[model samples]
Target chain A: MTRILMKGNEAIAEAAIRAGAIYYFAYPITPQNEVGEYMARRLPEVGGVFVQAESEVAVGNMLFGAVASGKRVFTSSSSPGISLMQEAISYMAGARLPVVLINIMRGGPGLGGILPSQADYFQSTKGGGHGDYRVLVLAPSTLQEAVDLTMLAFHLADKYCNPTMVLADGMIGQMMEPVEFPENYVEEPVPPKDWATTGCQGRAPIIIKSLALDPVVLEKNNLVLAEKYKLMKRDEIRFEAYKINPKNRILVVSYGTMARICQTVIDELEQENISVGLLRPITLFPFPAKEILAEAIKPNIESVLTVEMSMGQMVEDVEWAVKDKKPVEFYGRTGGIVPTPEEVKDYIMKILAKETPAVKSWNG
Target chain B: MLTSFPSFDKRVIIFAGAYGSGKTEVAVNYAIGLATSQSQSVSIIDLDIVNPYFRSREAAFELEAQGVHVIMPHNEMCHADLPIILPEIRGEIERSDGKVIVDVGGDDVGARVLSSMVDAFAPKGYEFLIVLNARRPFTSDVAGSLKMMRDIEISSRLKFTGIVSNTHLIGETTTETVTEGYELAVEVGRAAEIPVAFVSVVTEVAQQLDPNVVKVPVFALSRQMLKPWEEKVKAVRGL
Candidate 1:
């Protein structure tokens, strides 16, 4: 396979095409506008659908309808736009329509600046919309990983009968890197579309809806979804542990682009004779709690710092895994501010100094 | 194969092509090359409004520090979604004591912006060079190259005076890869009835290639669009 330079947004868009996505409906928003733009130009060439819908609200519904019709469909948007699509995303989840969504997250509670951020971590993992549902969230730290995870998003969405979010940030979207695409991407052997609305040809018509009038029936539906969630936690949890040594005292936990920054910090700290390991979660939904617990309980591990581009969302999950056994410190820069490796290194030094006051002299 | 570019007779030169065709890289190199090697004062404008990643304006400060004039969007307009061609464009077009190279946006949509400025450049006899990088999906074949050239001309309301074969696979570009692109570019030039202008490669890549094989004018490049993450990624992956 030949590797080529690609930006994260356009690479994911092309990956969606290679993954058998037949339709793309999106409202362009930074820093993910390239995804929609590239899809608009490339989709037609591949006999796929690309619609620059009037609004994200409209495109979200379009995705629900297209995926409900048993066709592979996906959309890309930033934070504000994803917030607008939550209603339809919830609908797609309730209907069990397999659809892929890319969130190249930027700063915000509202119209935030168009820069890299992981503020949408909770929005992606904690269920953005009002419903008893979950979206499979895959966070990619590299452009190649972006392509791989994006392709897997479709397969996983279909396998689980739910939506999968390829969560990224503006830095991931705008940064250029070399990526080799899968050559033998067989789009076949897809999930069975047994519940599609392809006309009532041979049997009783089926209805897809999120509403349940009967409390007893709704409780049963919730239980079934909860079991699936448990299955995901058991079988589909994905993470990567870097340089994990039993003698490592500080474990730096991070995801997305921030984790890449954390990897550099680990190297810098290592040179300073500090044993720090990097625990990066690939699948944000399953939370990699098991991996976190195992690594955190190792001897000589005194602290775990959760680094993020948001105001510390993933730290809560790290805390859940730690269960107060070890102190899990949170370091974050919000509103699209990507903390530099130097800044992260400084933060790590501060954490170390607090642990043992003499450690501050190691900075030189 | 012309080993040397024709003298800077034309007041304005425009570079246009597919988004990843190395237009910005070429324009920056061309401007710097002229400023250092020639007697002409050079000003390069970044009018690219299509893709935002690899714009010439990103290197404006570097170019200006070296006595080359760089005119690009200012203030918050740097990140603006819509295209905003500065009004100074007319003045720059009118008062041409030296050379001005306009790095246009990619595709017909971007060329449409250039169409509006053709009248100003027409009197000065501007040269529009359609850069072709065979690596890009849109210009990977002879047919694709011709189709894009025709579409670009139609939208820009100008004829392409020459073609620039700037094929590169980022850091993986080899001599044979460039020679293949040069061959493809020769066919494209024949079909378009235009001269195959100088081919471009980074200086290091040029060293490995026997110049006799390419037989084309070469512009050795300096990689300018290094993003924040690329250096570390290259070190880690060793690409």
Candidate 2:
């Protein structure tokens, strides 16, 4: 009904409440601490639950507990905290429990820094935890998109009986932008949490487990997970292409905050007739390989530049998607450094200025 | 007796106040008001480096579309948490004409950045107005508001010339709330020894108030901070 200026963290917290997330358990982490603070202060008015767990490990288990009881719940964390929660996340994934996790990523292999980053791309999309399981990962580039995707994450998690991760960078978490909450955005038509472990009263006991000791049963569990992943890839592949006209010679590929930066690069370059287009992946787990493929193979396309806020993790996927059909170049700024639009534009120009392709072709 | 936005004889107007005092929103509305008034060309520099959560830059496109130039750090830096102070701002500050609105960050830590521009701004003085919201935490009393203004002035190396009360309690804000806030604003202005620039009342609530009751001019405010769901809740509950 009305638009309001809101920070991404606070917006997500309010959106979760608006979406009927009755239970939220999270440990405080930078660039996302506001989410916990907002929930702790506001959840009571809405008849919801908010717990500041002692640690990330505890919060992860708490998430599993809430979801096991068939309630909408989520937790937000940064890189190091998410790393500590991986064990419980792995358990939830293997157990096929539905939960929402918002990872507002910061630079890290360890506690690197608190600035915006997309370095956690591999850890998120390639399955951080142990198994053949995949979390439905949604990457949002703007504050409104973050709110929209978070609401969608709850639906996706419940509909598939799988954990869904809202993979945003520190920028999306800390930045202030105008956002509108969907009118009465409550989680509706709740897919029967018929599998919940709510005290089996006068009914058959339900058990949800990830610990399978027998090799045969474990293999079957893995296969079942693989099938779910396959279905998610088939149905949930989301991507957005900006200005991918025939005259464009370069395809800039990125997602989340990086994609947003590339959009600016495209805008600035369009003035000079540099003809750069952007292919942004909205769902990082499904990877949007098909859409990127279609745009990258266009007749006038000369090169594909995979830009990231990390050491070229998504570039490998781009290369694999293209499979040497065209050269997929990588440009990234790691360790909490967010590359400027000028830097990205300059990087692309250097690639374009080359007299010929930098790499030898796949020739006969 | 003033019935509309006030005239600005000064070239540059700087908005500075304590955190959550509604400075950014006031600056946005004030800038828009000035732009629409055709008194001068307007440009806004978002100088808030302390809080990345709310700043004037978020409304740049809207202001720009209305022929108001918005100057902020380019690209991701506009959204980043880094303390990015560019030289481009100095150039805007040096301009002798037009209304240059500087929406500074809240508190002294936010105002300290202005110290760097002292050399460029000293000769041509600016109107430094402290936006006051009595409802904001730690500012309900006259002493607290003055203390905050003193801290900001000491750090910014500039004295405040006026005060604007832009208080609210979100969707529930009423004329009574604005009246109470105005009482505090008057008390704070008397204590701090500054003029009351104006008291902003939401257009809906402003209609119900008597202008004679307000000691200073009333600036009719159209709330720009409400989000969609918040407005829905307000509409449903009749807030």
Candidate 3:
């Protein structure tokens, strides 16, 4: 296949199409409007369906209904728009429907700025919608990774019979890069969902519901959902460790576009003979916690730093993973301001400077 | 300095392209190159209302440092996504003294902004060039690019005088990418009855291009639009 330049949002939409996702429901939001725009134009040519619903509220419900018919379906939205769809997202999770959501995040608390941000990390990994459920969250740092993860998201969602999300920042959505789709790739056939609400001509009608009225049944349902999440955790954890070596003293923890920036920081510091490593989490939910801890507990690794475009949301998870075996530090810039590599390098230099005396005390 | 390069000789120059066609990058580089090379006053008007990221105005600091005046929306609404056209844009387009390069937004939706100022352009007789990146999905071929040119012309109420063949895959751009884009641009230009104005290549790739294959003037672009992380290396170098 030929390599072509594509924006992250457009690539994700095309990847979904290639993965046999025939139905798309979405409302337009900046930084990610390209996803819907690409789908609306391309889906029709491939005998697929594209619906511009009245709002995100309606878009989410449309996905819930469409996926119930056992067709591959997905939706894309930015932060606030994703917020509006949380109720439907929760419902889909409860009903155990397989669907894909692409959240090209922007700065947010309310209707935030349209610039790139990773503030939605908590909202995505921790469940934006209420209830005892989780969405399989995948964060991609590049357009190519976005495409690969989007394809994987459909497969994973179907495999687990749950909603999966591609959590990315506006930078990933808007940046242009060279990407190649799998050439005439065929997906492994998934077994037909025996639980789908297909026609009931020869047998009893099937009903899928999230509302377990009885307390005992509700607990059992929640437990079943919990077990599915455990299975995902066991089989689906993904991450990348860049420049991990015994010579490294500082380990940088970051994900999405922020991880790319951290990679640059590591390269810059390596020039100064200051060895630093990076751990980029690809799966945000089953978030490579053991991988982070494994690196943090190494003898030469003095401290771990979590950098992000948000005000240190993922730092909590990083700290939890480290469990104080290595001092975990946090540096962040929120409101769509991405922390520069120079700023991050300086922050790491500060940690190195501060840790010298602490190390001397411990050694003495 | 290279002697043979695309020169915007017209008093008023306008650039429009499909999304990710490298129009804004070309516009910013042209303004800076013109300002740094010549003593003439240069000002770039960022009239992009469609895209929220990678607009020419993002390089205002660098442009101003190079003595090229940068114009866009006012301070408070600078980053707002709303289609806010300032009166100063009209003033800049109407001014007769200096060179004005207008970086219009992408596609027909963005080109509509130019239609609003068709009267201002009529008197100036602007050189409207469609920046074509053949790698982009919409303009990947001669037919598709010609259709985009027609669509933009209809929406902007302005005919393109030339084509700026700017095709690259960012860091992965090769000489072949530039040549392929030039080939597509030439085909589109022949079909549309317009001159293939020039070819734009990233400065590094431009240096490596075989002049025998490319007969037209080349505009070597120092990339102005950069991702946050990519900016760090350039910033540290103090460029």
**Residue-level lDDT tens digits of model 2 in B63-148:** 78777888888875775656788887898889647888898987788899998898877776788999987765447788889889
RMSD of each candidate relative to the true structure: 4.6, 10.9, 3.2
Candidate 3 C-alpha lDDT tens digits along A50-77: 9999999999999998999898999999
Candidate with maximal TM-score: 3
Q: Which numbered prediction scores highest in lDDT against the true structure?
A: 3
Q: Where is the poorest 10-residue window by lDDT in model 2 chain A?
A: A355-364
Predicted structure 3, TM vs. truth? 0.96
The sequence of per-residue lDDT tens digits that candidate 3 reaches over residues B57-172 is 78888999999998988765777788989999888888747889999988988999999899998787689999999888889998889889889999999999999999998898
Q: How high a TM-score does candidate 1 get?
A: 0.89
Candidate 1 local lDDT, residue B3? 42
TM-score of chain B of 1: 0.92
Model 2 interface CAPRI class: incorrect
lDDT of 1 at A176: 64
Best-performing candidate as measured by DockQ: 3
Please list the residue runs of candidate 2 whose C-alpha ends up more than 4 Å from where it truly belongs after superposition.
Answer: A186-190, A355-364, B1-239
- DockQ by candidate, in order: 0.22, 0.07, 0.55
TM-score of each: 0.89, 0.68, 0.96
